[model samples]
Target: MKNVLHYKGYSAKPEYSAEDQVFYGKILGIDDLVDFYTENAKELEQEFHAAVDDYLAFCQEVGKQPQKEFSGTFNVRISPELHRKAFRKAQEDGIALNKVVENALTEYLSPAWHENRTVILPEEMAKMYSAEEQTVDTAPDDASHLALWKRNWTVVNGRTEMKKRC
Candidate 1:
């Protein structure tokens, strides 16, 4: 079950108030503290949507721009040793430290970053298997479809081992 609600490009992490018997949430990733609450679980989503609409309407009335979830600028802390190493690397590459960090983040977030991960696309599978054997109808990018493979990999004594989960 999802603990967060999303509406109009905004999200909120809601909590249940056992004492008050209401589901309440505050707008996330924004400077303003916008909140919503509903006594009925079925109306929780409607309340969240109404809150977002009201917030947007109010911003428009006041001529104030609504805040986006992410601003693309955030501070990250690192160890002195790691910082020095990154600085030297950035200097050697003739780029700013920010660019170096951005490149590292990009590479880390890339789908192929997991070396042991094995994802066979439809076209790739066609080369090895017969058409009759191809039963995967969902897109390869669908995480739920990929999870159905039930293949697990773990490092065992410095060696990667692939095992099937029961």
Candidate 2:
């Protein structure tokens, strides 16, 4: 019989059996463990591949950027109730509670306005934009697309007019 590992704050000890490890390790895409001891190695590989593809698709849809490594942190104290709320929210959001608190504090301290707008195009639209046949002179009929182009064009024209006056 394998020993169980107790996760902090949880009453139940998680079974550390080879079968349990195989299941979780496959879910986490740890191929080495799955291949070494799992009987359903082929199925685990397929599942891992599918998960990676799904994650990639989700990242593309959501415009997720590569995570950057953070090197420093500052400590702050909060009320127990607030801490508990944050912890609950973090669990619901599938993020670390510390990250949730940091994000909240960062947003609170930062100004609402941003210097640049990051645009993410759908795969088809991105392909269209990258194609040499598409020219800036061609206007798109979509209202939101037209609005963005008009806004930037207006800014450039305004800058040019200001330059002429000066």
Top model by lDDT, which number? 1
**For this target, which candidate reaches the highest TM-score against the unseen true structure?**
1
Deviating ranges (above 4 Å) for candidate 2: 1-71, 113-166
List the candidates' TM-scores in order.
0.59, 0.24
Model 2 C-alpha lDDT per residue in residues 1-166, reported as the tens digit of each score? 3222222211111222574655323223222222122346455434445544555556579897323334567676778987888888889989997788778779757764223333344555455444333323323355564444332211121121111100
Error of 2 at 158 (Å): 39
Off by over 4 Å in 1: 68-72, 92-94, 104-153, 156-166
lDDT of 1 by residue, 1-166 (tens): 5588888789998889999999999888788999999999888888989999999999999999898656679998878998999999889989999998889899879975655554434554345544333322332344664555444544333333443332
Clashes of 2: 0
TM-score of 2: 0.24
Pairs in clash, predicted candidate 2 = none
Question: Which clashing pairs does model 1 show?
Answer: none
Q: Cα RMSDs of all predictions?
A: 10.3, 21.2
